[model samples]
Every structure is written in C-alpha cells, then in structure tokens.
Target: QSEDDVKTHKGEDQSEDHIGACRGENNFERIPVAVSCAEKPYKCSECSYSSKSSSYMKLHLLTHSDNRPYKCSECSYSCKSSGNLNKHMSTHSDEKPYKCSECNYTCKWPGVLKKHEVIHSFDKPYECYVCNYKCKTSSCLKTHIRIHTGERPFKCSECNFSCVTSGNLKIHLRSHTGEKPYKCSECNYSARTSGELTRHKVTHSLDRPYKCSECNYSCKLARDLNCHLRIHTGEKPYKCRECNYCCTQSGHLIRHMRMHTGEKPFKCVECNFSTSQSGDLKRHMKIHTGEKPYKCSECDYSCIKAGTLLRHMKTHWRKAKLI
Candidate 1:
C-alpha cells in the first residue's frame, strides 16, 4: 500500500517499517485512513456534533439514546455517562469549591464557573437572528432562540406546563414535589430556585443595594427597582394582545389577558367560586372562612373586601354632612 493510503493512530505519517508492520496480513494494528485532513469523519445523525475519534463518536451516540445506566441515590436524576452522574451528585451537597474571581459566585463544577466567568466579560459571541439579543455562550443562545420560535421541548408529566430549557422544567417540577433546595443561611426560609433564595436573603439585610436614580425609592432586589423606575418612565412594556391595554409588569399583562380569554384559573376549593386573578380567589377564601378583615369604625358592619369597607364609611360621611 502507498504511504498516503495508510496513517498512524494519531492521524500522523509513520515510518516505512512501521507502515510495513501495520500492512501485515494478520495485523490488527492497522489504522484506518482519514477521510479529510481537518474534517471530522464521524458525524451524529441526531445533532451537529462531529468527532475524528471513533470511540468519542460512540460515546456521543449515548446522548441520543434513552438508556441511562447511571442513577442518583438522592433523587430521580439519571444520565448515560458516569462523569455526568458524578457532577450531578455534587448538587445535593453545599460544597462549592470553584469560585469566581470577579464576583462572590461559587459552584461545585469547574465548567459552571467557566460559564459564570463569561458574565464578567464584555465579549458576547453568540447573537440571535430574530432579535438584537446577544449572549456569552451557545447554550444561552439556543435557549434564547426558543423565545422567538416558541419551541418548548421540556415538558412536565404531571401538568401541561412546558418550558424552553431543562433548568426551568426542573424548577417547575419542584412545585409538584414541594422541594426547596436553596435555603437561607440567616433564616429557616427556603426557595425552589437560587434566584428566589437570593431575593429572600436581601430581607435579612437592612441595606437596600438597588436604588432608583430618578427617585429616593430603594429596594432589596434589582427587579423591584426596575419595576419602580417604570412608574416614573411610563414604560408599559407588557401589552394585551386582545385590547389596547398596556401594563408595567408581565403579571399584570397575564391577568389582563385572562379577562379577554375569560379564563378563571384561580378556583375556590371550598365552593364553586372562580376568578381570573389570584387575589380575587384569596378574597373568596375569606368568605368561606367567615373572616371579615375589613371593618367599619362607625358601626358593626364588616366585609371580606376593602372596597366594601370604603362604601360603608361613605354612609358615616353622609350622616355627618346631614348633621
């Protein structure tokens, strides 16, 4: 065989003696000829992954299969690879050895720290085709693409709840399991997600780090500060599709949309009462409990709603004006 017809295991040109030895009739050490110099011959049918190594291609194929041999002892978490199972096991503990240099961020995995470090840098290579959104990693760009495409791949078995990312689906599953993995160090308070725990931790501290430049208003969370700034800026970003109604918050827009759809999502467990808003459902619950929180100072009139108490006070005002 010609020198060009055979190559070493490392994709390198070998000596004539080494090539002759590999060319033996019963030689099992004969390395396969590479298809291209720079191209990866092994390609995945499921995804865009490609590898030059045959063993790596075999390992990558496992990602497409439902055969997960490795399982977690603490949870229902399972994976195809042992390395991934080892990484997931660290999440059950509070041990975070990897720390970010730019911030107080710490994670159990080195790859997570590497991803977190990108936030400190101004470089964002991945850009969205539909929007002006840019992110540091390709994984983040993939998640952002789902926003424009409206593709929710991760689904919940318990409900119709579906999300774009697996991380979001994992958090949503916690609602059914009643699992609060993130806990507050100062208090006994716990939260389903790290962001919720972070917001809760601010309540323990007296200092309000997020302050509004337009006003003297300050808040523990940056989210609240942004919402407060919308009041001064008149930036009603959340708009109703059915009507010309616009709102400062997404929750307000969701509630407004329910009015258009006539969706009574908040239903009373005790009675047949149902409402579009959660607060309305809460007030309905008070009726079943016989809890008249709103009382009139003029008389023994009491009600479940504040609006009823305000109307009762008007009766006193009318009597005083007549006197």
Candidate 2:
C-alpha cells in the first residue's frame, strides 16, 4: 500500500514511511489504516447520521431513544450516560465534590460549578435581540426575551396564575401552599412572601432607609418611596376604567374598582354590615364595641370617628367666638 493510503491512529500523515521498505535497518511498525469514507461501518437506524466508529453511532442513537439505562438507585432520575447518573446521585448525599478555583463556590455537579465560574469571568455572552440588554447567563437572557415576546411560559398547575419567569411562578405557588419560608424573630409575624416579611421586619427597625427628597416623608420600602414621590410629581399612573377617577398607586385603583363593582370585601363580625375598605370596617366595629378613640382637646367630648371629633371641636370654637 502507498504511504498516503495508511495513517496513524491519531490521524497523522504516514509520508515518512516508504511503500514497502523501512526508513532504517529496523523494520517499521505498521500504523492503523485510515477508515474508508465510502463505506461507513456504523449507521444509526434512528437518524440519517452515520459514522466510521460504532461507539459514535451508539451515542447518537441514545439521543433519539427515551431509554435511559443508567439510573440513580436512590431516585427515579434516569439519564443516557453513566456520568449524568453519577451527577444525579450527588443530590441524595451532602457531597459537593466540585469546587471553583477562583472563589469559595462549591457544587455537587460539575456543570453547576462551570456555570458558577462564569460569574467570576464577568463576561455576559448572552444578549437580548430585542434591546441592548445583556446578562451573564442564558437563563437570564431567556427571561429577558419575554419582555419583547410577552411569553409567560411558566404557569401554576393549581391555578390560572402565570408569570414571565420561573422564579415568579415559584413565589406564586407559595400562595396556594400557604408556605411562609421567611419568618420574623422580633415579632411572631410570619408572611407568605419575602417582600411581606421584608416590609414587616422594617416595622421593628427605628431607621427608615427610603427617604423622600421632596418632603420629610420616609418609608422602609423603595416602592413606597416611589409612590410617595408621585405625590410631589402628581404622576397618577393608575386610572379608574369605569369613571374619570385617577390614582397615583395601583391599590387606590383596586379600591376605586370596588366602588364601581359594589363589591364589599370587609364585613363586620357583629352584623352583616360590609364596606369596600378595611378602614371603614374598623370604624364600623367602634359602633359595636362602643370604642370612642377620637377625643376633643378642648372639652371631654369623644367620638367613634375623626370627622365627628372635628365637628365637636367647632362647638368649642363657636363658644370662644361668642366670648
């Protein structure tokens, strides 16, 4: 055979060897012949992809089949390769074998550790096609794409609740489960959501971090500060659909909607008396409990409502005017 006809196992040129003689006095070892491209030794019945090696064809066949021979003994998790099954087995144990060299990051799976390494690089390969938005991970890019596509793929199986991202859907699922993962140590107040817990914890703190530049008003939440800033700006984003009424916040718009709908959610325990607002229901409770919280500063006059106290103060003012 010609030198060009035969090649090494590493696909190196056999140009150094002669046709039928050795380079020196010692006989040359016969290198493995190059596999013929015309006749592919291995062919996958599942797909059109054919290869010279039987191992490559077998691996390709696994992609088509749902048959996961390699499975975890602890769990129902099944994978095509033994490597994936070994990775899945780590979930059953507290073994985080793979560790990141750059940081203190460690994970059970190598793939997870690889993803963590991307954070240290500070290179965001994924970019949104719709805008100039870029993020570190592909998952973040997928979530950002929903902004343009309006695709809320993740949905709650329990209810009609759906969100643009999986994280939002996970938070929404807590409402159905009644799961309050976050708890306040200061007060025994448990909240279903993290934001609720965060806001609740702020009541314990003396300092109000979110301060309004326009006025002396301060709050715990940035969202509340944003809403407060609208008071100075007079920027009412929410408007009543039924009427010409407008509001700065969405909560006000929701309450205004109840006015048009005639849907009274808050009800008195003593009577069938119901009101759209919770504050109105609390005021209605004073009628049953006879709780006169509002008091006049001038006289021993007290009333259930603040409006009644203002009217009672006028009587003291009228006497002073006559004097």
- Give TM per candidate: 0.61, 0.44
Candidate 1 per-residue lDDT over residues 269-310, each given as its tens digit: 687888887798888899789999988887889999899899
Candidate 1 lowest-lDDT run of ten: 22-31
Candidate 2: residue pairs that collide: none
> Tens-digit lDDT track for model 2 on 1-323?
65655544345564544422321212222323455667664555555676665556556667777687996676455669887677556645556789999988677777778877887877888886645556798887876665445456777777544557776876776666665555677877877555687788888888888998888999888898988898898877555545677777646766777766676756666888988887998899988989999988887888998899998899889999999
Q: Output the worst ten-in-a-row residue range by lDDT, candidate 2.
A: 19-28
TM-score for model 2?
Answer: 0.44
| Residue 298 C-alpha lDDT in model 2 | 86
RMSD of each: 7.9, 15.7
Per TM-score, the best of the predicted structures is 1
